[model samples]
Target: MVREKFTHIYARAADRKGGEAELESLLATPLSAQELKGISDDRWLSAFTQKVFQSGMSWKVVRNKWPNFEEVFFGFDIEKMLLMPTEMWERKATDPAIIRHLGKVMTIPENARMIHDAALDHCSFSAMVADWPAEDITGLWRYLKAHGKRLGGNTGPYTLRIMGKDTFILSHDVEAYLRNIGVIDGGRDTRKSLQATQQAFSEWQQESGRPLCQISQIIAFSQGDNRL
Candidate 1:
């Protein structure tokens, strides 16, 4: 009886539609490593990379200023960054091309030193990527937050999870949809709600002989109504 009830609820929740759009709307536009490498000097890349990290603001603003940031920060070259003194930080802080946050401006050099040290120890950022752990969500979480990454705390974890990179199972949207379908108790604790969904999803996958990817398709199809 409970099985029939859950299957019906799942069918209803899955009918919402436009899951892809919902996924697209939530992603942040961060630059890839390959794009970051095009700059002439690593110093500019270093400074700009850190600048983007400091960008708690809109990604579009950061994306637009990427070239300017490279120009202003000596192409993020680590040596140049290490050479920079307090005067250089003050100069960049006043520049309109970059974020201009004093704290972020100052963090560039320090971050450069850290990156440099890491490079020496780990053989550049590329090497670390090459040696990355499992593609499973939990492994991705450990990798991202590994080695003092400080990945923006909970929101960062949530973002990575939604993008299918890390330990999180249920997304905020999925949880909301579950509530909309009246599967788990809406007023219950979130942890409990999430656990219940995970269990139900697991069982459904087993019974339906569907992988998570196929399940994602079902989610997208069912939730089509969630478009912008």
Candidate 2:
């Protein structure tokens, strides 16, 4: 099966979304490396923690309760988070002030430690993530999965995206497009499938001169019934 070129994809998305300008308006741009580097490690930890809690749950629910999460986690400061004792974690898990899932709540300290360690190695977690090669973003995803708690699958990808890292998310629509284009063959999460996705997106990025995020969104908008 032949794969669709970026031009064909973009045209379909544009037609569905009310032309080029409308499609562009719907697309989100990723941050520059310098911009990503300037963000604090605390923000990185907080963003990933938010994604962890939002996983398999209502994102709006998490958003509504975020201020409380910030307060309970002490603004997600790496040092302060690392200092939290096991007893404190247990207590906080049951606290009505935030989501009470012990498993998700526990991602805080371990992810904090991961970010803290990254900071020591790269001056800041922000610096490391921002510096990661977008061309091989799956590598960073793997790194996060190996190093951080509850950060595998789309969790890591979502956090990187929230932090403005230039990465693509394998969303339902995006995955569907990939399968339609023969870019993905079998199980969606398999290493082979992921690498195929990366390669396809890289080609599209080169062809369209668009960031992976934009290209990913364009593909999603092109394929799904989510039209205007």
- Report the C-alpha lDDT of model 2 over 1-228, residue by residue, as the tens digit: 237778988899999999999998998889999999899999988899899989889999999999999999899989999998999999999999999999999889999999999999999999999889878999899899999999998999988887789899999999887887788879987889878888888888888899988988888898878898
TM-score against native, each model: 0.51, 0.96
- Position 142, candidate 2: lDDT: 86
**Which run of 10 residues does model 1 get worst, by summed lDDT?**
160-169
- What lDDT score belongs to each candidate, Candidate 1 first? 0.51, 0.89
Task: Give the per-residue lDDT digits (tens) of candidate 1, residues 120-177.
Answer: 8656643433244323323433444453233333433443332332132344555455
Error of 2 at 159 (Å): 1.5
Clashing pairs in 2: none
Estimate candidate 1's alpha-carbon lDDT, on a 0 to 1 scale.
0.51
Looking at model 1, residue 84 earns an lDDT score of: 84
